[model samples]
Target: MSHVHRDRKKLLTRVRRIGGQVAALERALQGEADCSDVLVQIAAAKGAMQALMIEVLKGHLNEHVVAGKTEAVRAREAEAIMQLLGRYAR
Candidate 1:
């Protein structure tokens, strides 16, 4: 079974929390909050998103790369993940 399948609830909870953070950011903007407060909220939302990304990445690594049946499959998985990481970094 996939790691996500096993941990769906936990992952969904993270997603919901990130959504809430985004909603809070939207409200802050709509309310014409102070520039510094809005920036702080943006930072919080970014951090939450990054945390969710890391969680999903960890599941992908464990399920597809580390636990893959063959070296070629593992290498391919790792390569794909690295490519995504490269894009994300930019």
Candidate 2:
């Protein structure tokens, strides 16, 4: 099975938490919360998103790159990861 499938439950839990953070951010904006409070919410949501991305990236590297059966397959996975990082970095 793929790493994503193996880690589905854990990933889903993180996603749900991120969703809650986003919802809180929305509510803060709607409620005209203090600027500092809104900023804190924004930071929390951003950190959660980054954490999720890192987890998935790590899994992809481990399963598809490090443990790949062939050098060609590993190279392909590395290129895909590089492409993803390029987009993400911008």
Candidate 3:
């Protein structure tokens, strides 16, 4: 899990930023901000979340798919991740 450990702080920071974006979205909704501005903020939050997912997926692939206890386990892990990615892709 070194991939994840090495980037823990960075990932946490990203998550925090996403949280801030969500809070901003909430405030904008409360204050009745312009539709375009609110949509942009929503897009920002969605992009941040997608980035986080990519990071975690990379770590999982490196740690579990590439370094599992056995070939069978690794294949299973990789297949599971691939299935999730397939769904995400759509």
Q: Rank by TM-score, highest first.
A: 2, 1, 3
Query: Highest lDDT among the candidates is held by which one?
Result: 2
Which residue pairs clash within candidate 2?
Answer: none
- Candidates 2 and 3 compared by TM-score, better number: 2
Model 1 residue 61 CA deviation in Å:
1.2
Candidate 3 backbone collisions, by pair: none
lDDT of 2 by residue, 62-90 (tens): 99999999999999999999999999999
> Cα RMSD to native, each candidate?
0.9, 0.7, 2.0
The residue pairs in collision within model 1 are none
lDDT of each: 0.91, 0.97, 0.93
Candidate 1 on 1-90: residue-level lDDT in tens?
788889899989988998898898899999979999899989998998898899889999989998999999999999999999999999
Model 3: worst 10 consecutive residues (lDDT sum): 1-10
TM-score, model 2 to reference: 0.96
